[model samples]
Target: MKSIVILIFFLSSIIGLGQDYIFLESKNGFREIKLGTSVENYPEFNRKDNSNAELFKLSLNSKADYVYVGSNDDKIKTAKILFIYLTTNNNVISEIKVVTEKVLNVYAILNSAYGEPSSKHGDKWIWKTNNIECSIEGDQNTIPGYHIVYKDISNERIELKKMKLESTKKAQAEL
Candidate 1:
């Protein structure tokens, strides 16, 4: 009985990690949070109050905008998942990252929506296209959890974002 209790405590504290990447090719986004769309459209990204989640804060730098999904988001509905972080450029979402457990359900959901994964690399599964890339892999950077990253990788978009950043920096330097 004591051994069983210790095992339960150990299991409860560790987050499970499994899943192939989700979303269609060229998605450049996740759900309604599409890349190249105005960040103003999603008020959830504006709430920067996740400092209370001390464990989640440890792996991130200040540039990472930790998103707080709104009430309307009924979650993924089949897993212990959280839309933990995102980044925007030119006021548009460039990346979205999530952490999830019990992700077997997510694997099925994504398999149906996105078809076979492009490739599997050890514990990670990835789907890459000309426009975007999505992957689900083990990330022990902070807490024990699987990571899902959906990012825009269009070359034109990258160049445009770079130009904008440099232009803004140049403008700041003039000050």
Candidate 2:
């Protein structure tokens, strides 16, 4: 019984240590909060014209359940999304790039937030996209942007929805 208890404690500690939060900033005025250590360096994403983008801060929740990235710039004209997964050793196990040809913009007024639902309501998670927008060219056959949402542990999926700029504004206002 004592041996089993010790084993359980050891395993728990190992699991806990594997989770962490990291903040990344670029020279081009881009900032993001990310979970795990697999992050690109500042120079790779930063542009010479934007020096304010090189600073970022990240707050890690107790459970490491969510990470939020806030930026200092109000005028983000375009952004590409990437999902990264970290292994127990803090190495990036996988990375998937999301293409965005549409003119994407993140709303300066609202913040991006995500959280896990309380147990009383069962295991649920919510992610707020804030005032994100995309402007696709007329000739493009497919929707230009994607919605990435967390489904469960180790699972994230992207769902694409078609909409006009006017409708997108209305939908964001309703949210």
Candidate 3:
């Protein structure tokens, strides 16, 4: 057991483990994008169009507060980023969803960007801060590649509160 544990650590170190790029992002938003900023700053990304794929139908543009924006030309590090979805809260970016190509070196690239994951569960690796939560996991259900979610914790809380209030209102409406 001891040998197995040591071996795992050794391999992780060799695979590149460190919080090298932790200071580069503003609360875990994508690349130069930020969590609390208005989406108007990024005119490069437009509202995701109507598409037939399950991965493409994730946007909730109908909601007054939440919106998903994407661009076909976005890339994580080098190239071949399959999908990039940015979910916004009242026009402020709150979450990011990325699905990379199957052959991409996802682990290494993600490690370089967010440093080593704070924790790992099954195939999912999560990195958390006081205000941001980021995770990347392998999903075969929608795509045969990686699915990454980077979100703002505070905005998430706000959304959750709104949902709870709505739930309460609905329950009282039937009373």
In TM-score terms, which candidate is top? 1
lDDT tens digits, residue span 1-175, model 3:
9999999988776444334534424445767767778878877665644552344543322222333333466555554566566677678877777666665577777777777778999778887765688888764455455777777787567789999999999999999
lDDT pick, better of 1 and 2 = 1
lDDT of each: 0.64, 0.27, 0.65
Error of 3 at 42 (Å): 1.8
Comparing 2 with 3 on lDDT, the higher-scoring candidate is: 3
For model 1, what is the error of residue 78's alpha carbon versus the real structure, in angstroms, after optimal superposition? 1.3
lDDT of 1 by residue, 1-175 (tens): 9999999876654422112222354455777677767778876564455564553363632455547543434456556665456777877777777766645666656556666777888767777655777777764444455667787878667798999999999999999
Candidates' TM-scores?
0.60, 0.18, 0.59
On lDDT, the leading prediction is 3
Candidate numbers, best lDDT first, in rank order: 3, 1, 2
lDDT tens digits, residues 1-175, model 2? 9999999998876553322111111111123423223434322332112343222111111122212232433223454432111112233212211222233332211122112211111211222121111111212243333322221222222222333556788989999
TM-score of 2: 0.18
- The segments of candidate 1 whose C-alpha lies over 4 angstroms from its true place after superposition are 1-23, 47-63, 69-73, 139-143, 156-175
lDDT of 3: 0.65
Q: What lDDT is reached at residue 32 by model 3? A: 73
Q: Identify the runs in model 3 with alpha carbons over 4 angstroms from their true place.
A: 1-21, 24-27, 48-55, 58-74, 77-79, 139-142, 155-175
Report the Cα lDDT for candidate 2. 0.27
